[model samples]
Target: MSMFEKPSQAEQELKWAKIWFKQFSHFHKRGGKANWDFSPDDVILFLRSKRDQRMPAWKRMKILKGLLVYRRFEQELPIDPFSFIVEKMKEIVANERAKQDGYDTIEDVVGVIDPTEPDAIQQFRRALRKDGMRLQTERSYVGKVKAFMADRGLRCLADFASVRASDVEAHLTDLAVDGNVAASTQNTAFHGLLKFFTLVLKRDMGPIEAIRASKGKQVPTVMSTREVASVFEGLEGVHLTIAQLLYGCGMRISEAIRLRVKDIDFDNHLIEIHGAKGGKSRLVPLPDELVEPLQRFVESRRALHEHDIANGTASVWLPYALHRKYPSAHREFRWQYLFASHRLSRDPRTGERHRHHIHYETFPRHLKVAVDSAGIDKHVTSHTFRHCFATHLLWSGTDIRTVQELLGHSDVKTTMIYTHVMNRPGVRIVSPLDRLSEATGRQPAGKSYQEGRIAYAAG
Candidate 1:
């Protein structure tokens, strides 16, 4: 085509497709197959590769659309399989364009917290967000700080500025003595107040000499193997899979639900847990029995992702401003949550509609029902499974350091708690009463006087 002449529609589409295919070929070399010998998965991989390179969303979409046009008109290949990609890319392009036009993007929206919230609380929240605190942590901190302000009649920023260390100390003491809050609760409140004064108010808080809440050394609740099996019998489908992950992989409920499709490696028999407690990542061994079930689960998740794509809502929330970095990754299959919620929900932070993982609370509710059905008397929560995981591993002779790493504990001291609860077969200690009975070749007497006399006479 001459410089002044306009290219035909067919020529333009072919050019677009060729440009995309060229880039795709660089990533995936065509040895003996034709240039067009690629599947939807290949197309997805190519798009993801572009995303990783931080390519502009519009450019990526243009190339992909060109490929579709060329394949349909020139190659006469079926375009049905690529429909999901087309729809998802169109949505991405529209969002990018909207952002370019100075429209309010998802990032511009405020969180679900009330707009009429106190200015001090809002400032505290902003500081927490700037520090990359988790949403739950932010809420807790804000609540505690707000309570402190309310209790002290500090209605505004100026009031917060006047807060002294003694005031904080007295308030915490009151929480322990008057409110009767638990040790952890008081400590959480203390930390929240400390952060608010130090970070938000920019004031130095002197040493806190408040009367501390009494803390007790409480062991975690762990289910026996039989009770675990009984609970499993009550749970089915996604809940069962999640419970298994909690116990089998030593994963916290938050870690299990937040899992992405790419995190699971079936061939390696490993699961990658990212952004776990303390913002750490670790690999856990995938149970042999879970391999097939997880495969089937992922396949179903893919189908659900396709449906979301067709509906123009195929996107997930990426942490740490990753969406800004990899614009197309949010819509990729690998980023879709492993255990996605059935319905689309509005993001609290961005106010955008996206499919999040199943709510963390849902598992515990199911677990409570399962525990009750299993006739378990222990107070069982979703976290009990994690405790069971650590204790059972120790019981089965797994090294403590290995268990610590799998549980993602930074210090071995945390993992040592399980050793107290774990039962050792070889080191098992017989009760004194049982030992006495064994030595004398007779059963121990009952506690009642009449039963004790009869048992003594019989012996």
Candidate 2:
């Protein structure tokens, strides 16, 4: 090509091909090869090496594109071995860019497939929703399935058909050995893939024999009554009420936030928690202290609901097909969220304007501020209140089974975790140092321990 003339597409491709070959030559040489001649297996191994080295997706795609152009136009190979690999690389690059742009959903990762085409992710999501999975759980399962597909370079729906139990075992083993992910995370990924294969793909995933991630025992953090009171002093208004509900009712943050007006039974003095973890419902005794304040809060919320109704935006979200079954139920005062968002927003799934609950982060942000103001040293979160609730109840001599029922834990063993942190008076054992001080008839002194012993001896 002349310097004055623009280079043709073929010429530019050849330049990139030269650059790709130079890198390939170095890789081949390191593997004890003496010549430029290479096979498809060699190329595949080279790409795997790059992946193991954590090369950026875009750079990997550029390298694969050069190789593809070289094989098609320069070498004139009868069959292109790199064509499928190049397309898969392009998909990987697209997914990386989408994630960087904060588009994490499976639909966003695999953009706009033809309606007639079989979409594994779309089928997976539909199956999950049909099974009445919670929104958070659905997202988690979808994300895990997407990660499995990305790991095996399965870009299209057809690629999923060829997936075997061995492939799943290898991916799970890699997560344990290479990624060092938590045991719960690995279990979630395993279940997600298992569901995809069995439910969505209608394939039997023969028993998987994969290396499992290591599990560690973690004790829940419990706050003393004094510390809990101090934290409450720093918090006021809606945040304080939410915190109290978490501690007093033994409700999870999600369960507390999703509370509708009808869930609270003032006449019966019970707070009905529906759709808690594991899709179970339970009734917890309403705290005597919260009754008056909650009544006042409810009155304020009623006024807000009326204001929204006057403005033609009093709609709240109803689960499943409730809106279709009871058209006017969403507009009723009893359906309103006890802690509704200040602003009305469009539901991403329905595209309808509704007043959803407050954002999950808002309460935690306020809790953090309160924790700082109260000078609490331990790590604190919204869930800490629930932990405190369980441990404090145990300390106050509540039966473990009763605590389990109130917390909505499915198993008594699951509720036993709080027992490890409870400071029960019946189980108190004196420290050895205190026992020694008692035996010596002298209290242990900070700097005057010897003087205290001498004084005790003289006495």
Candidate 3:
């Protein structure tokens, strides 16, 4: 409103300033001491908006920390008024610093700690995404990092460098000591942090060489052949098909559920698994037995799709918009799932309720029941089938490479773990004492057992 101020500049800045003020006012219309506070840099942006100007990209980012500082510390001015005097907003920061320093007790001091410092959680997420981390990995990183920050009172990304490895060591030790986390479990968590520091934070954590974890004493849980059969037979309907796929295709539950109708190539006898783990896709030979069950499922699937379309419920997946591209693709055979969800599911990426495939969680509930009914006499789960699949394949003289490919393992070393279960291929030697005859120079009752069964089976 100054007379000497450039009319165009003054008009542009003040006009948008008022507009932004109204937005905040509207946001806090039902408010007490409306918490929306803006700092000097925020005011600069409001003025910049008026002149139809944007701050230089680098300078633009710097303003967020200032705004965060304003929101967290200064309660005197609304964001709009602060935006005008953003450059002169240093006093509020100093006051916060003074208050932070004023606390005598550790608990009070911790309370005074600024949570919005540099907002590292947000920054770390962006960094991980840019680094092409998987959605699951990104989620894990967020959970682990958020917990770590909350526990240790981290305010900014820069504070990570100050987070001593010893502190992390103590935490890992505590987890192992209190939670009884095995060495491997502890390593996974510690390595997650190591990845965050070395990869995301770009910190020179020096290979985490000294990070030693307590080793875990664990045993592999393998479902017996009889148990596997029992669980396999006890399953029914889609649940049966699901378990069949688990054993038949040697697939994890996650991989089985992600299957689409298009993934199976009946003519080529190939089943394509896309980016199953570690973002790598591979094709495995389709089990011949699965073809029949899959065909039966498809018959029902086609009907379901038709019914859904007729009832305005089918055709859920919509072939990823292929319905629009090809127009007739919705009714096509390739577009139908071999094992389809009766109803459509929403597209997580698009937020559109279009069916993708059978959900991963559905079959497992029924699988546990089948496990109990089969009378396998062991605590087993769906993953037990996958474990048995690899072991059985190895027992049937399947090559390690073939089994590895079928199991979708990136390394042969992972497949080699199953080798321990199959045992070495060698001749069994009987003790000389077993050759002894009884009474009439013939084998006695107990001694004749192996020969009788061997000869009987031979007959």
Candidate 4:
């Protein structure tokens, strides 16, 4: 069958009818269709007229789906995955029955300290997350806490810090041995557990890095300029524009996806990024190339906003009661999305269907398609654009400090990473090999600093 082929109504019915007939048929026998001639039209009508089912009925439907396949195989017809799905449904029903009978166990179901307690770990976890603690951090901390508690089999809050350094070491060793979790992964877990013991539980956990991690050997993946161009060119339509905003502005994918129309300042050519990373705001220079697209997007989005509002679907993000403060902001064109989703989305915090930014997964799907078309052999992801942005800027001789501001890095030390991308001797413009040669006084090894001084003077 062609990959994209849409099966005809008759062909579809025969396929499903055989399935239902098989479920009711005995496995050893000809499966009940032995007496009657098979017809596609009858099967189609049967499947179409099948009633909506509760879970138990759904299980029976799965059994029917399986039987159709078994008969098809006996007759040497084409094998479809739909038959496999029927068999899986049988397994699911069996598993569900066992669960109800308590023949099997589920993780995290009961017997942990009550999370509703004022200072319980789960309560803190919820509070920190609501207060905007990073998701990865929360996951890591929860994992570490669970591992530590489960090993000693301690469940009470009173057990905190009663476990010694050896217990922590044993846990880390077990993770390395049994779980095979990476050294870096273990370090993150350690840091999270350390934070809890030191900060929240008020314990004297001296030297948080006592169980230190080995140096990780991961290098950042970045696309070369030509590869980046090809990737963008292969992408059709406005997706390229969104990718450009991601790479060109050096913004995180989350920040770019969450952006609103009013965030753009055309007058000053600045893009305001609000509530980034730390519940703080920062602004970056908007490229001149993006202006026309932004304007076009704005006009189309305004028309959509009117339609959505009329349909009672335009629930805008005028956060913290700003909707009350500025009564008409929700209906305003400047407050709508520049690249809104094809479908309306509900806010996680508020259960309201408002037109929001495009979903994160959609862009990644587009990116994968673009990557295939571009013929990029390297594994590339959405965040690779951010890495490319930093590397490209560094390669172009932009100062580290400037790239740091654009990337929103709090530390200049973090910006030092791009020096590897440049392969140039860092800020001092001195290399380790040159230093070694100079130390030996071998052939006046290092290149002269005269041109740098002269170029510096010219600037």
Candidate 5:
């Protein structure tokens, strides 16, 4: 449509419904044969199928939001389906909150009923949790299996056992050829499926020749000093603080957000990073410039914690077995997140209402806005700051070993990617082309170029 033109109401409704359905697919996918041209009734049937699947309230809300427009215009139903789903979600949330507030007995906390393949997948998740997989790793593994099952029409654990090694291989091949997924994504899915089969389904996927994704050397994107400054110029407040930590402390966004009150030592000028990538801990030097601001930020966090305590909802998420051992630690000020979220949220896993840390997604959203507003052309993510941190440190003559330690990299080689990203592999040397151009007898050929016709040769 042109700028002056508007699409018909039906056209607009269908467009919006499609967008919502795509969003829904991110978290929920039909696990059986689904018609591509699904009607509103198909959507309703799918929702009804998930009644016992133990979906979080927030996710159900997203589904309802997606389907509301479709149900309103495209179909006539006996009841307002969207409103029903909305009320169901609200009830779940309220029940969860009530339980947290001691209004319900322990019996009120319910586990998955009428267990399906999804419930069986939860068993695998519990095993992963017991083995102490990082949250991101768990999500990736679970998501891959969910996507695979959805694609192959695997409705239950019985279907999982029947899947052959060839099936797994073909699925991965399709991800590369059909989905056009990135090499890393393909690798992740491949490994995730193998793991799900072995660990979750308790079946071996032996000797499969899957068409592997092309593995290319990946170098992290780094911003120049001027470009880095430009990103900061557009950001202020907590966003700026988080970005600064990403660049200054060589911390991942997850580590930075999960930083707790007790982790920072103002007197020692060190920040303790616990439960980082690979479940390792390390200390990084706190930037001299950020100390006072960090102190003030901590004060604000403490205030929030005090308010939460008074409101009887001060719990913060603790790493495995710690919360169980130290039940009161969740409510402690020292255990409070350094960058607490503005509002209290219910933990999807435990259904506990508490003030959690700032979500990992929030920083990236703000950083993208800042980077765009600053007119930086690079694809700057929260991680780009980390790349900048390492590269800048190396450029300023920091030893490789020290940089590795600061970066919480288990191996020095892992930290060595900065050398490639910095475009300074091995000892820095002037290019041969530049050297030749600098010679007295030779000027750069392209300095003054002219288009001239060449003489035609007779064959």
Candidate 6:
């Protein structure tokens, strides 16, 4: 490309913008729209509004250079202002990350008080809190109820009275059809709506005659013993120990991450899972293999706790009114998370900065890396270890009832799925073909009944 040859308008614009941004752009600190509105004149107005802000001459000149390109592309301004100011984008990205890092409480992230949410939706959320639902449960139920209310345009408590069974049915149908939501998701949404109508609106959610989403029982993926060993071989340190607990106790990822210092009882070789699924408490055996490693891990956690205490940032989240009842419980070691995060985070509710648990995502991310390095191709995740725990126990001839108790399952039927997933070929009726091979005889295609009697009987 010679200098005489004209470059495309888009290429020319990108080239000019790149030079300006790298040369200049982060000279002043300011906020921009979380998502740009993308109207050219509106963008220009936004830029003009920044003129009154005190910034250096270089920063002003850079803005002028960007403005020329934006005006050239004014008929079709880019949705992202950062694309034209790449160097200026790092500070904005950093600010977003800082916000997330500082956010420690679930109530801040999931329990947002949306001003636009309807009165009935607000009441439903309050009802959920009063009933003492888990933070994750409350978030799910509130979001579903909000979607239902918005679908029916129910703004006030009075508007809820006007809602009918058909409206609810239509919403569920759309969830299955338009949203293509799974059977479990659709069922969860139905339950949330049912609670809202029954408890908050004081009305029965009459029969929903709509076509329901297919609720087929899905067989959970289980790791073979060899696969499980390979996964563990690829992991070490805290991650390895966490994976062991997941497989050893048949604990869910959330249950493991939420473990507090007092949950593990090394003396009795027991682990108490509090507020498990359905708000039930249960005790599971702490594996003899993990006891020593776990004790070491807990000692390390104690060191971290002491460090935080000296820095005056050792508070942990206390459920319900325990903080009110105990007052000092938040600062107690017993309430501190066993798998506490390395970074300190600010609790939006109390403004008390503290260390939360290792982020839930970190385990799966590192687990994936380990799995790849080990060259195991099957789709495995942190939860796969839990599945392996239950399935392996069943294969080892452990009583179904005992496995159910250890897994904190409410029904033996829920625990029964592991039986179906276990590698139990001999338990199943042997096929005649296999029996024929074992009997030192082959199936003769033209043989009469008498000729195959021995093979048939053996089978």
Q: By TM-score, who's the top model here?
A: 1
* Ten residues in sequence with the least summed lDDT for candidate 2: 105-114
**Model 6 lDDT per residue over 401-424, tens place:** 999999988889989888876336
lDDT of 3: 0.62
Q: Estimate each model's TM-score.
A: 0.72, 0.69, 0.58, 0.56, 0.69, 0.66
Q: Write the per-residue lDDT of candidate 4 for residues 283-350, one digit (tens) a residue.
A: 89989988888778777877888788788777666653456557777767777767788787765434
Q: Pick the candidate with the highest lDDT.
A: 1
Ranking, lDDT, top scorer first: 1, 2, 5, 6, 4, 3
For residues 118-138, write the lDDT of model 3, one tens digit per residue.
567665655554344555776
lDDT of 1 at 19: 65
Q: How does candidate 5 score on lDDT?
A: 0.73
Q: Write the per-residue lDDT of candidate 1 for residues 421-449, one digit (tens) a residue.
A: 63565577778888888899885565466
Q: Of the pair 2 and 5, which is ahead by lDDT?
A: 2
Clashes of 4: 3
Q: Which residue segments of model 5 deviate by more than 4 Å?
A: 1-119, 421-459
Candidate lDDT scores, in order, read: 0.82, 0.80, 0.62, 0.66, 0.73, 0.73
TM match of model 1 to true structure: 0.72
Error of 6 at 426 (Å): 7.3
| Candidate 5 global TM-score | 0.69
Model 5 lDDT per residue over 318-343, tens place? 76446656778888899888998889
